[model samples]
Target: MTSPQAAPLANAGPALHAPLLASAQIVFAQVSINFGAALAKGLFVSLAPEQVAALRSGIAALLLLALVRPWRRRAAFSRRDIGWCALYGLALGGMNLMMYAAFERIAIGIACAIEICGPLAVVLLTTRRPRDFAWLALAIGGLVLLMPWPGRAHASDPVGIALALGAAACWALYIMLGRRAARVGAPNAVAIGMVAACLVTVPAGLARGLPALDAPVLALAATVAVLSSALPYVLEMRAMGQLPSRVVGLISSAGPATAALIGFVVLGEALGPWQWLAIAVLVTASAGCSLGTAPPVSKLREEPLT
Candidate 1:
């Protein structure tokens, strides 16, 4: 999300590994994330979106706790570090909530497209190149193509839209805070953040979905955590370790397309031919900005803070 922790891993590029395996890992991680999104949708009928989000973080936290055992480790940070970790955790939880909430109200593709506005803003603001603005225009045009005029009779929920955008903003914050956390040697920040998210979400989830957590439902919900939270997080982290941050972020633009595919297969969500074209347009815009731009030498210094 914050361009994958770049600095420490930038030097650990694919040249040190097999290119084919590295490429495969990236694709696999991206696909796993998409599959996770579908699984989350599947849980919606029996669980509220908030509950699904909470259970996901809770289960993921437990699994990570078992594996990483952060509690058994020595204190890696000074007291000053608590602020960054808390901020990062809060942003992480917020992002998770808003994203799931967006999925509840809109198709995954459109919701992701809208949420992407945040990272796109990050890219735009960081650079002064006029050519990059073309990417902005392209993104805008794609958005226009996908979103028809909303009338009083045909209006999508504004609240959902706002939530998605808010998620995007949180994602940006997550990136910044995540970087700080990485710096403080909290290598398990993702897991810890999941635990933090669980702390907040699990209670609310119980209130809303306790009665529904029968054996089958609990199993399915755990499966959702594995698919949506654990697998993708691991895969993304692994892939990010190999790829450059900018390349990784650009490739992640595929999320919407992946979500669209998952939406079609799992949710029976469909779009007109024009929407497909729009997807292509957005992909191209993202790719153009990502690929055409030269990698900065300074990128070698970019690392995750968490």
Candidate 2:
């Protein structure tokens, strides 16, 4: 018999179900986030990226507070768990801040393509399976096609590109940390982390986007928070409980493609044939992963939120 931890690697037992569900939840989570971000981007055109991030995090914090009331269960966590949660929250905040910064300088699709590196790295690092490398290669090749691999003759902001990649690294870290935190319970860990992210973003937004956070913008930001963070977080937690991590990670590779679609449909962006092909590669890889697994049996167990 396999140890419970090893169970997730192979289709060992009922535990394999959790990773499978986690995979599906990951798709739902990324799609929801991309769509919500698209909506928020329009509403936040007048606002600075910092301001928008602040509003998103602040609103998410309030919703999480209302939902989990972390203070009410503080005694439940050990000091080590508390430390891990805090680190997780900080990573979350940093990732968001950096991603918004990236978006400010590049096209949304381009920025997302850069950010994809984070999770892809995670997938590469953990697996020794040769078959999985094909997916990894597909993801990388797709990213190369999506990125402005053109020389200096036609380049965007290098700093912005760097920031987007940084966000990707933080994203990968966030996933790893989130999985650890999920072991501490998704809702509680997320709530605690949001509080930390809130601390990081709210102040920065206030400092940078004070004028933009007035009534109308505040309302828009609130909506963005609900759409981009709270709702997705809730749904993802539910989905993760029923999915597997490998499947979840694989599905999440579709994030860039979803972001591209959101940009096209909502933001009037267009894609060429090669770009569309890249999207196809990513989506097919992700969907193939999901299809390979069966539906999970339960919705109560917590799953990965990355």
Candidate 3:
């Protein structure tokens, strides 16, 4: 008789659950970030991009500090840990600054699409499968079509594209440092890194007269902090620890479409029919990924903040 273990189970344990949950985590992160972007655009008319970055970063740092209370467990991390967190924070700050700068000069979806080039490069370099290449090509094709190229006679601002590229570089560094920081475990690592980020941003805001502190602006900034800075960092960090960077990067390719939809809704930034078709291709590409088999079971064991 065959051993019980020898039999193939129709559905077994967390085999079905873990990847689905991981995919959901990624999708939720994309949604939260773009909604936050929409809110940010409303404030751009009142505040400069750098000023907005300072506000969002500072508020997010404060919120994360309160929730994590990293002060209580300060002794857990080594000097090396501290260094990694510092660098991680710096990368995040740079990314924020670059993205906001790009946003001021470009459309939301376009800036987001350009910023994604960083992570997409990381994924392409690390991946070996031809299938992964096909997926990446499809997603990228959609993005290229969506972007209003210079040759199309409506040249996008070169400075804006440059800033987006800078943000992409920062994002690549952020992802690398983020993975290292994740090993330092939850709240302590994230909280400390955010503090470092605050150092970069808060000072800039003070120099700019701290517009985010005004009564009317403060509320919106707080919401932006929650949805964009706080939620995405926390959620993405969690998922990064569980999934391979390439897999996470591939899944995040849906970001442009998500941003486009949010921009269309909140800012009335309408997309042409071709843009809609591009969005559909992005969706199809992200869906076609092997999400179920990408992250192994070992990844599911999260290290608590404690």
TM-score to true structure, per model: 0.82, 0.77, 0.76
Give lDDT per model, in order: 0.68, 0.69, 0.71
TM-score winner among the candidates? 1
TM-score winner, 1 or 3: 1
lDDT of 1 by residue, 84-196 (tens): 66677777777777888888887777667666665566667677788888888988898776665554232345677678779878777776676676665544666566676
How much lDDT does candidate 3 score?
0.71
What C-alpha lDDT does candidate 1 achieve relative to the native structure? 0.68
Residue 50 CA displacement from its true place in model 1, Å = 0.8
lDDT of 2 by residue, 1-306 (tens): 788887667755656666656565666778778877776677657888877887788788889889888778777778888778878888888888888887777556666766766655665566566655776677667666656666523344678878988887887777788767766687888888887887677777788845534688778778788878887777776765464544554556567778878888988767677667766775554444333333331111122232
Ranking by lDDT: 3, 2, 1
Which of candidates 2 and 3 reaches a greater lDDT? 3
Minimum summed lDDT over a 10-residue window in model 3 is located at 297-306
In candidate 3, stretches whose alpha carbon ends up further than 4 angstroms from where it belongs are: 1-26, 128-155, 206-212, 232-251, 273-306
TM-score of candidate 1 to 2 decimals: 0.82
Candidate 1, residue 303: how far the Cα is off, in Å:
14
